[model samples]
Target chain A: MRLKGFRLLTIITALVLSNNLLAQSIDDVLNRGQVHGNFGMDMQYYQVDSLIGASETPDEDVLMNGFANFIYTNGSFSAGFRYESYMNALQGFPAQYKGNGIGYRFASYTNDDMTVTVGNYYEQFGNGLIFRTYEALGGLGYDNSMDGMRINYKLRDGLFVKGIIGTQRLYFEQGDGVLRGVDGELMVNDFFGGSLKNSKTKLTLGASFISKYQADQSSQYNLPENVGAYSGRFLLRHRKISFNGEYAYKINDPSADNGFIYKEGTAFYAETAYSTKGFGLTLSAKGNDNMSFRSDRAAGQQDLLINYLPALTRQHTYNLLATLYPYATQPNGEMAFQGELVYKLKKKSFLGGKYGTGILVNYSTIYNIDSTAVPTAENDSTRMGYTTNIFSVGDERYYDEINVEITKKFSKKLKGIFTYSNMVFNQAVIQGKNPKKYPDVYADIAVIDLTYKINKKNAIRTEIQGLFTQQDQQEWATILIEYSFSPHWFVAIMDQYNYGNTNKDVDGNFNERIHYYFASAGYVRGANRFQVGYGRQRAGIFCIGGICRTVPAANGLTLSITSSF
Target chain B: MKKLILLSILTTLSFTIFSQQEKRAMPSVNVTDMEGGTVNTSEFNNDGKPMIVNFWATWCSPCKRELNNIADVYDDWVEETGVKLIAISIDDARNAGKVAPYVNGKGWEYEVYIDSNQDLKRALNVNNVPHTFLLNGKGEIVWQHNSYQEGDEDTLYEAVKALAAGKELKH
Candidate 1:
C-alpha cells in the first residue's frame, strides 16, 4: 500500500511537470505553430415498422458513428491523425466497419519547391478518370485512402510533377494490390517566362500514368498481373471562352464488375464554355467503354474503386425529385452529353423588376454505347467478350433530365426562387434491380421557395414542392418551413406525403399512402453546432457528387454534433 | 468505457487550450481557378485588409441561400469595411463546369475559385459546405463558423468591423 501510494504521487508530479513544459513549448511556437481539429457524431435510435418496409431494426436499438481529426502544423512541417468509431455503424453503412480504429494518419513537410508526404493520403490525377483516392462520408460512406509515400515537385513556376506509390484502403484494412502512378502538368505560356504569360490566350497540358499489380489467384481465367492506364489532358482559355479535353486508355483488365471480361478500356471527356456579362453557356460530352478499374479484382459495388466516372445528370435539390430517381454512372460503357445556359435580365426592366432576374436552363442525357456480343464455343469463356464502337450510341436510354430555374427579388424583405424539372429515369438499369418489377419512371417536379426577413435578426423560409409521375408511387407533395433566430438558433419542420398510389393489392385496394414527417432544431456557437431530429425516413437511393448508396426505410430519433477548432 | 472517458477528458482539455491560444495563420494549399489554372492560397493577400473565405457547392440549398443573402448587402459591406469575399466551390468534375455560369447568372461580385478535388477543403479541415472563415489584416484566421442561419452575416460583418477598428474580439 505504501509503494502504491508513492507511485501515484510520482505519477501526479510527473504529469504536472509535463503539463507546464507543454504550455511553455506552445507559447514558444505560438506565432508559427498551430493546432486544429474537428469532430462529428451521428447517433440514432431505431424502431421497427412493417407498414413502410422498415423491418430491419437492429437488436441493440441504438447505434452511433463518429470521427475526429486532430492536426498540428508548424512552419512547413505538419502531422495529423483521424480516429473513427462506428459502434456497429449506422443501418445503411457497410457491416465491415464494426469497431474503432485510426483510419487516417499522415506526416508531411515542404522544403523550397518540393513537398513529401508519408502514410495515409488522398490524391487525384486529371479529372479523376485515371486515378483518385478520396473520402465522401456524408450521405454515402465512401472512403478509399492510400497508405504509402507521395512526392510533389515544382520544377518551375508553371511546371509540376507528382509521384505516388501505395496500397489503397479496403474498409479497415489495406487491399492486396499495389499501386504506382506519376503525373506532370505544365503551363505553356508560363514556361516561356516573360511576355507570353501576358498573352490573351492560356494553354495548359497534363499527362498521367498509373499501374496496379495484384497476383493472379483466380482458378478459372488467367489474369494479367499488372494493368496500366494512361491519360492526357489539355486546356485552352482565351478571354471569356475555355475548352478542356482529356482522353484515357487502359490495357485489358479482368474484374468482377465486368464479369471477368478481358477488354481494353477507353474514355474521353470534353467541355467548352463561354461566359460574358449577362449570358453564359457550357457544353460537355463524354464517352466511356469498360472503364471499371479497382484495386481488388474481385471487389464489387462501391469498394476499392481506383477511378471515378462522373454521372452526366442534373443533381436535383428538391426533396421528392432528388430521392425518387437518382442515377449512377454505368462504368461498363456509356455516352453522355450535357448543356447549360445562364442568363440575367437587367434590373429596372419589365421582367427584372427592381432586382435583376436570374435564369438557368440545363439539359443532360446518358445512353449505352453500341456493343455486339462475340460468339463463343460451349464452355469456352476465354475471349475478348465483345466489341464496342466509340461514337455509336445505343437505343437504351439510362437517364435524362431537363431543368429550368428562375430567381427574383420581389421586394427589400422578400425573395423567391422557382424551379421545374422533367426527368426520364430507368431505375432497373441504374439500380441493378429487376427491370420487369420496377418499370421506367417519368417524372415532373416543380418547386417554389420563398424567404421573408422580418428584421435584421429574424427570418422565415418556406418551400412547396410537388412531383407528378405516372409510374412508381404516382405523386408526391412536400412542404417545409424553417425559422431562424439569427447567428445561434434555427428550427425546421418538413412533411412529405405520397398522395397518389396507383398500384392495387390482391383485394383490389390501393397501396399504402403514407407521410414521412421530420422536425429538427439546431444550435450553433462559434465553430460548433448541435442538431437533433426525429423522423420517419423513406427508403430510397441517397447520392452526393454522383456516388450513390441505398438507404433503408427507418423510424428513428437522430442526433448530430460537429465542432472544429 | 475507458475510451469514452479519455475522449471526454481530451475534449475538455482541447477546448481550454484552444481558447487560450493565439490566432493562427492560414495554410498554403493549391486550388484551381475557373479557367483550370492552379493558384496557391498563400498568395491570397489583400494588402492588409480583411477577407472572408466561403466554401460552397452547386447542389447545396443552404449554401446558395447564404450567398444570396450576403450578395444583397455585399456592396454596402465592402464600402464600409474594405472587405473582400472569396467564394470557393467544392464541386467535383461532374458539376464544376456549371460554377462559372451559375455565378454569372446570379450577378455576384465576389471572386470565385474551384476546389474540384477538395484539396483546400481538406487542408482547412472543412467538413461541410456553407462554412465561412474570417481573416484579419495579417492573414491570421481570426474566426470561423459552421453552417448558416438567416442573419449570420450580420455577426460576420460585425467581426470584420471590429477587426478594422483594431479591437480584440471576445470570441
Candidate 2:
C-alpha cells in the first residue's frame, strides 16, 4: 500500500511539472478567476418485488442524481472540474455511488492542426469495437474514461494521426492496468486536388492499433507482458449508397473469464446502406470469437473496457419486449446478420393513393461459430489458445427475428401503421442462462397504431399490440391512448395484460396472469417541461444498439422534468 | 416555369422564417487571450463576427482529425468569408496543464477556449463531447454537427461560408 501511494504521488508530481513547464501563462493564471457552471437533476422512483437477490422492498422514494460543472478557460489554457452528487441514484445504479465530490477535472489546449490534453477524458475509435469511452447515462455505465495524456497531429492534405496513453479510471481511482492506442486516417474527399471532386464518389481509410498491459497475477496465471490489438476500417459513400467495414485482431492474454491462459481473438463488422428519396435499405453482419478484451483481464464490469462492439439488432422501445429477452453480444464465437428495408409507395396508384403509403421490413439472426479448444499437456494444466474449424458452423441458430410494418395516411387528419413480427428466441443463450430454457419457437407479435389530428393544435394517438408465446411466458396484450395539444399539453394511458403463461400453481391452474396500467401527463412551456406517470412496469428486455439489459418487473410512479435557461 | 418560380418563392419564405428563429439559450463567458486580453462572448455578436465554436478533447481521435481537416481549409475560409473559430478544450486540470505546450508543438492557428467545468456543454445540451456549434454574426446558432468522419468538414465549411454570405441553407 505504501508503494502504491508513492507511485501515485510520483505520477501526479510528474504530471503537474509537465503542465507547468510547458506553455507558462502568467496572464492566464492571474486573470482566470472567473467561475461558470452547469447543473442538472434526475430523479427516479422504483418499487420491485424481486431485484437480483435483494429482498422485496415495498419502499417508495425518489433517487436523485445531479452534477455541477465549473470551468475556467484562459487563452490556449483552461482548467475545470465537475461536482457530482447522487443521493440514492436511479434504480440499477451501483449502491456504493451515493456521495458528492469532484468527479472529474482537466486542463486542455488546441491549435489549428495540433491539440494536446492531459487529464481524465472520454474518447472512441471507429465503432468502438476496440476502444470507446463515454458515459452512457441511460445504460448506467461509463465504461472507459482515462486519466492520461493525448497528442494529435495533422499532416499534409487529409492525413491525420492521434495517440493516447493512460490509466483508465475506475470509479474515483485509476484501473490496475494500462491502456494505450494510436490511430491514423486519410480522407479522400478530393483525393489530391480537385479533378476528382466532381466525381460522385468519396472514400475514407483508417487504421488503429491498441494495446493493454496488466501486471500478472501469479495466483491466477502467468500472463503475457503485453497483449496487443489492431483494427482497420474502410468507408465508401456514393450519392445513394454508403458502406463501412472493420476488422480487428488481438493477441492472446488470458484471464479468469476464459480460464487462465490467453486465447487469440478476432472480430469483423460490415454494413451497407442505400437510400434514395423515400426508399432506404441497410444490411449489416458481424462475426466474433473470444474477442472480449479489457485492460484489466481479471476485472469484469469494474475495470476499463478498451473497446465496444455495437450490436446490430434494432433497439425495440416497446416496454414488454424490451424487458424480457434483450439480446447481449456474445463476444465469443458468434455470427450475426441484420437487414432492413424501408420504402415509401408512390402516390395515386392502388395501395399508394393520394396519401402516400410506406412499408418497412427487417430481419436479424445470430448463430454460433463452431470452435475447438486446444488440449493442454498433463503437466501444464492451463487453457491457452484454441483452433477454429474453417468449415463448421453451429448446428442450431441462437436467435432469429423477422418483422414488417405498413404505414398509410388515410386522410389529411389521420395516419395509421400496422406491424407484424415473428421471432425464434433462444432463452438459454439470450435470456435465462438455464439450459432447460431452450429455444422458444413461433413467438408472434402484432401491433396497430393510429393517429388522428383534430387540428394543428390538437392530436390523438392510439396503439394496440398483442404477443403470443407459448414457451415461457403467456399471451400478452397492450393498449395505449395518448392525447396531445401541440404547443403544450399531453396525456397518455396504457395497460398491459398477461393472459398466457405456461407456469402452473399447486392447484394445476396456469400461472395467475397479471395486468399493469399507467397514466401520464405533461405540460411543456418552452424549454421547461415536467412529466409524471403512475403504474406498474412489467418485466422486459431493454436494448440499445445490440446491447441489452433486463429490466425487472416493478410497480411505481415515474416522474421526469427538464428545465433550460 | 411558373410552378418552379412558385416553389422557389416558397422555399425562400421558409428559409426566411427559419433564419428569424431565436437561437438556443446559453450562458455567457469571458476568455482571456494568450497576451492577457479578455474576450467576452457577449461582445462576439456585436462585433459582427461569425464564431465557429468546436468542443473537443485531446483524447478524442475524431476531434483531432476534425481540427486537422478544418485547418487545411481554414485559411481559405478566413480569406473568403472572414470567419473565426474557437476550439474549446474540455480536458480537466489533471491533463489540462499539458494542453498549451501540446498545441504549441502542433502549431495550430485557431483561438482556443478552455471549458473545464463544461459551462458551455450544459448550456448547449451537449449529450456528447466533440459536438460543434456554429453561431452567426448575431450569435444565433446556425448549424451544428455531432460526430466526425474523414470528409465531414466539407459539409461544415459549406454551411459556414453560406451563412457568412447571408444565404440560408436549403435543408
Candidate 3:
C-alpha cells in the first residue's frame, strides 16, 4: 500500500510538471489550460433477512464506493487520472476492487493529422467483434480498460488509421497476455475529394486485425501461443435506406470457456434500416460460432472479454419487464434476429388529436446454432471438439420476445404511454441453471405511464406496471410516482410486489410474498446533485447492454452524490 | 495509515492547483456523424449562435425523456433564440446501428452524432449521460449540468436566451 501511494504521487507530479512546462512555452498561444472533472460516491447500509433470500450481511454495516476523474486539457495536449476507493466494495461488485488507487491515467496530444496517447485507454474495433475495451460503470460493474500506447493518423481527408499495443487490465493488475491491433477506415466518396461529396449516397469500408500472445502452460494439449482474429465491415447509405454489415474470423485456439476446444471461430452481423418523415423500419440479424474471444484462456464469466456480442432483443425500460426475463447474449454459438417498426400519426387527425400519436412494434428471437460434436476417445484431451456451419440454426429455442408501445397526448397538461410485451425465456440455457431445477418461463407484461404538468414549476409522473406468469415467482406488479419541482428538487417512490408465489415449502405452505419498496429525494444545483433513499432491494440479475451480474437482495439506506465541472 | 494520509494530502493539493487555472476549451476529438463521416469536435460551430450539446444514450430512460421533452418545444426554442441543439449519442458498437433509426422514429430535429468510442465524452469529463453543456456564441462552454428532471429544459432555454441577449447567466 505504501508503494501504491508513492506510485500515485509520482504520476501526479509528473503530470503537473509537464503541464507547467507546456504552459510556460506556449503561454500566448495556449493560454491557461482548463481543468474539468466529476466525482461520484455510493454508500449503502445493509440488513439481513433469510425469508427473501437476503441472508448474508456484510460484517461491516456500511459499504462505500467512490471515484473521481480529473482532466486537464490545453490546446493539443491533455492528461487525466481516475481515483477509485472501495472500502469493501458494495454487494454485486467484485470483491477484488477493495482499496484506493489510481485505476486509470493517460496523457495524449494531437498535432495536425497525427495523435498519440500513452498510459490507459479504451478502444473498440469494427462492431467490437474482435477487440474492445470499455467500462460500463452504471448498473454493470465491468471495466476492462487497456494499459498501453495508441496512435492514430489521418493520411488524408477521407482515410484514417489506428494502431494499439497493450495489456488488458485484470482487477488491479495487468493481464498476462500482450494485445496488438490495427484498424483502418476509408470513406469512398470523401476519398474522391468534393466530386461526390454532395451525393445522396455514401459508402464507407473498414478492416481490422487483432492478435494476443500468451505463453502456453498446458501439460496435455499443445495450445497455440498466439491467436489472431480479423474482421471486415462495410456501410452503404442512399437517402432513406442504409445497410451495415461485419464479418469476423478467428484462427484455431483452445480456451477454457470453450471447453478447451481447438475449433476456429466466426461471427457475422448485419442490419439494414429505412426511414423517412415519421416512419422507420429496421431489421437485424447475427450469428456466432465458437466466438468467445478472451485475453486469458483461463478467464471465465465477464473477465477479459475482448469482444462484444450484442443481444438482439429489445431492451425494455419497465422495471418488471427489464428484470424478469432479460436475455443475455451467448457468445459461444447462437443465431438471432430482430425487427422493429416505428410510426407516427399526423397531428389534427382523429387518432392523433392535437398532438401526433407515436407507435412502436418490435419482435426478436434467438436460437442455438447447429453443431455436431466430434467423436473422440473418452480420455483424449487433444482433439477438435466440434464441427459447425455458419448460419445453421439448431432446434433448441433460446428466447423470443414481442412488444408494442403507443404514446399519446390527451391534453396540453397530460400525456400517456402504454406498452405490452410477451416473452418466452429458456432459463436452463441462458441462465445456466439445471434443466430439472427451473422450468422455462412464459410471461406477459403491460405498463401505463402518465405525466401531468401542474402549472409551470411542478409536474407529476406515474407508472403502473404488471407482469403475469405461471413459472418462477408468478405474477408481479410495480408502481412508481415522481414529483418534480422545476430546476431544483425532485422526489420519487417505487413499490414492487410479488403477489403470486405458488410453490409450496416443505410444510406444504406457499412461499412468502414480498414487497420491495423504495423512496428517494434529490436536490440539484447547476452541475452538482445529491440524492438519498431508503429501500428494500430484491435479489435479481442486473444487466446493462446484455451483460449481467447477480445482485444480492438487501434492505438498506443509500446515498449518492455526483458533481461535474 | 501514514501513507494513506499522505496520499490524501497530495490529491487535494493537485486538485487545488489544477482548478486555479482558467476555464479550458472543448477538446478537439474526432467523432463519427450519422452519415459515417468523421467530424472533429473543435470544428463544431453553429454560425455564431449558441449551441446546446447533449450527451445521451438510447438505453437511458432519463435521457430519452429529456430529449423527447426538448423535441416538443425545440422549434419554438430555435425561433426565440437562434440556438441549435446537438445530440451526441454515446452508444457503443452494441447499439450504434440503432441510433439513427431511433432518432428518426421519434422525429427529433436536432443534429445527431455518434461517439461510439466515447472519446469526446471522456475528454469533456462527463461522468454520466443526460449531461448538457451550454456553449455561447463564441463556442465557449459557460454552463453545464448533469442528469435531468422534468422542466429542466426551461432552465436550459433561459440560459440560451441569456447568452443570445449578451447577459450573464444566473446559474
Task: Score candidate 3 by lDDT.
Answer: 0.83
User: Whose TM-score is higher: candidate 1's or candidate 2's?
Assistant: 1
The digit string of per-residue lDDT tens for model 3 on A1-565 reads: 9999999788777765765555455553434677788888878898786666667878999998888999887777889999988887888777888789888999999888998999999999878889889986534557889899999999887888999999988767788888999999998899887869888999999999999999999787788999999999999999989999999999976888888887899999999988876888889999999899888988987888888888888876577887778899898899999998888888899887788899989999999999888988633556678899978999888999999999888887898989999999999999999879788899999999888988677888888999999988899999989888878888888888888878687998776777788787888877787777778765454221111222444478877777888
* Pairs in steric clash, model 3: none
lDDT per residue for candidate 2 within A1-565, as digits (tens), equals: 9999897778666655544443134323444434444444555575553323224542536666666666665545556776677775555555556667666777767677576778866665655667767654433635357788887666646567879899886665677878889988776663365865555676778899988878776754556868888999877767656677888888886765555555677888887776655566778888887777777877675456677665556555455445555567776667888877767676787877885677778788888888766888623535655777422467667778888878677886677778888887777876546866554655888888777778755767777889888776658888888777644567878887777766677999865476677777766542344556676655444221111222333356665554433
Better candidate by DockQ, 2 or 3 = 3
What does DockQ give for each predicted structure? 0.33, 0.03, 0.33
Stretches of candidate 2 off by over 4 Å are A1-40, A45-55, A58-62, A68-81, A189-191, A377-382, A389-392, A507-512, A538-554, B1-123, B127-139, B142-171
Q: What lDDT does candidate 2 reach at residue A65?
A: 63
lDDT per residue (tens digit) for residues B1-171 in model 1: 455445545654564466555567768888888767788887887788899999988887778878978988899988988899999998888888888878876777888999887878877888776789999888888898888777788999999999888877778
lDDT of each: 0.83, 0.63, 0.83
Angstrom error of the Cα, residue A33, model 2: value is 12
What is candidate 1's CA lDDT for residue A360? 86
Fnat for candidate 3 (0 to 1): 0.46
Which stretches in model 1 have alpha-carbon errors above 4 Å? Answer: A1-31, A377-382, A504-511, A538-554, B1-22
> Where is model 2 chain A poorest over a 10-residue stretch in terms of lDDT?
A542-551
State the DockQ, from 0 to 1, for candidate 3.
0.33
